[model samples]
Target: MGLFDGYNIASSGMGAQRTRINIVSANIANAKTTHTEAGGPYKKQNVVFEELLVNNTKNLNNNLQETNNKNTSAELRGVGVKSIVENDADPIMKYEPSHPDANEEGYVAYPNINPVVEMVDLIEAMRSYEANVATFNTHKNIDSKTLEILKA
Candidate 1:
């Protein structure tokens, strides 16, 4: 693969993980939320990512067979977030008699989010982001060194 392919791949990973971290932060921030503009408690959100590999193997094979193909190269097409989906699981309801939003049964609905799990997810996303950044930096340094060697 060309030098920039590394950058492209790493950038895509960084973007995806950044989005994941943002969602995790939002989920954690709203863990105790009992009321939302949507009419009930907050729902936890998660990020989804899709790979961008070439879907047509035949095209790749044909390209490989072409003669004098100096332009042919492998590339990472980058990643895309599929969606920010809400969890369908039921919210946790507690018996809070004095709570303002309590129902006739003295049950107050809260978000289904687990703060500890969200925090763990946040830590994972942060680590993944850092790893991607490090990978990009390494590729950059390698590119720079290669350029310097070429100049020499």
Candidate 2:
């Protein structure tokens, strides 16, 4: 791997995890949301991550072959957020007879989001982001040391 490959990979990881954290925050914020402009309760959102591939054909083929051979030397290009998708899970219905957004049956549809679950996801994303940051910093330090050694 090139000297900057680690930085690129770590930065990509940070970006993806940041996106995930944002989605989790939004889901938590709208957990009790009864309606949205889309005509229903707020749908929980999720971040979809995908591999960012190198454009070089040779690298791509080599990476594929390495994967087939179960080799760990194949350096991944990076990570990316493929999409932010709304959860398809059904909304939670609560009996709230006097609530403004309640249906005729006295049930209010809340977003299908659990605070505890969202909190857990948020923590995981945050930890992943921190790890990526640590990795990036470590690479920067190594690069700096290499430059110092070369100068000496």
Best by lDDT: 2
lDDT of 2 by residue, 6-114 (tens): 8888988998998899889989988888989988899999998877664333434446666667645555577788789988999889999999999999999998888
Query: What TM-score number comes out for model 2?
Result: 0.85
Candidate 2 lowest-lDDT run of ten? 54-63
Q: Record all residue pairs in model 2 with backbone atoms less than 3 Å apart, i.e. clashing.
A: none
Error of 1 at 111 (Å): 0.7
Each candidate's root-mean-square deviation in Å? 5.7, 3.4
lDDT of 1 at 31: 93
> Please, what is the whole-model Cα lDDT of each candidate in the order they appear?
0.82, 0.85
TM-score of each prediction: 0.83, 0.85
